[model samples]
Target: MIRIVILLVTLVIGSVANINAQSKYEQGMGKAFALWTENKPFEASNVFERIAEVESEEWLPHYYIAMINALNSFGVTDKEKLTLQLEKAKKHIEEAELISPNNPEIIIIKATINTAWIAYDGATYGMTLSMKNAELYKKAFELAPDNPRVVLSKAEWDMGSARYFGQSIEPYCKDIERSLELFATFKAESTMHPSWGKDRAKEVLKQCKG
Candidate 1:
């Protein structure tokens, strides 16, 4: 009876420790996200990279590292700097893929990174990068057709294409609207899970309306 009681106490202590660890991780992620939402991608990326280094078993940190790099690359005007950022984004995304190969979020980020490269210098890398980006997007959709992040990525891509070609953005606006609806109802599997892209979808939806 004493042994059983001891075992029960140990289990309870272990569970509490686990809960505290998870809460700490969520707090770190919240800090990173706050920086990201404030348009501090460089700082957010650093936070994410640190998290990835410490939580080698998790894929979300690596995914966010790639995402922040990709988002920051857009504002970079220096060709050399942009190229380096894109490469870093690609490397981090690849790391994320190793951790979660079938993850829709990782797949969509891969598509986004490749698309960013094409947008950066289409004259030199357009054909191949565009093909690869489209393939990644298709794979992501196949993997998780109902995922809000996947739908948002596709909608954003369509909006970019429309703008590049000087075409109407109305169709893509509808896509964004649908994605926002999904985002509203979407439930993440865990607090540590990827639950971004909703705010981004709303931002793009506003731009499309504008």
Candidate 2:
């Protein structure tokens, strides 16, 4: 009887501990995202780094860290700064892939990091990474064709290329519209899972119409 009581008590304590850990993780992510929304990306990345230290097994934190670096690397004027940022992003991308291999989102972010470098100096990186960039998006789409971000990202890339060559972007605009439709009904695996790219898609669609 005493052993049974002890076991029940232990279970309750463990459950409570798990709840507390989840609560902390949720709170930390909330703060980090708030910081990001406020345009405090470096600070947000710092928060994610702290959360990642505790949630070492989770891939989302690493994904966010890589994403922060990857997005920030865009439109950067200094080549040296861009290189350092992308290198850090690649490190986190590797970490995330280790936890969640072949993740479509991770793969897309990897492509975005390359796009950042390409955007920064197409003359320098375009010839080298451009093919790799197309391959990444292709692989990501093959993995999750219905994924709104994947569709949207690929379409955006195609549109950019078309515009570069003075070709029509209207064809890829349909993909953007399809991505929006998918976003309307899209469901994330969890609250922590990514549910992004809809707004960006909407903006792009508006551009397509305009």
lDDT of 2 by residue, 24-105 (tens): 8888877776676566777888898898889988898888888878877766789899888899899988999998999998
lDDT of each: 0.73, 0.79
Worst 10 residues of 2 by lDDT: 12-21
Q: What is the lDDT of candidate 1?
A: 0.73
Residues 1-210 of candidate 1: C-alpha lDDT, one tens digit per residue: 223223322322222222223466666777776665555657878987888888898888888788667755654568899989889999999999998888887887788677667767788878887778778777888998789888888877766667778998888788788888998998877654666666667777878767
> C-alpha displacement of 62 in model 1, angstroms?
0.5
For model 1, the run of ten residues with the poorest summed lDDT:
11-20
Cα deviation at 73, candidate 2, in Å, is 1.5
The count of residue-pair clashes in candidate 1 stands at: 0
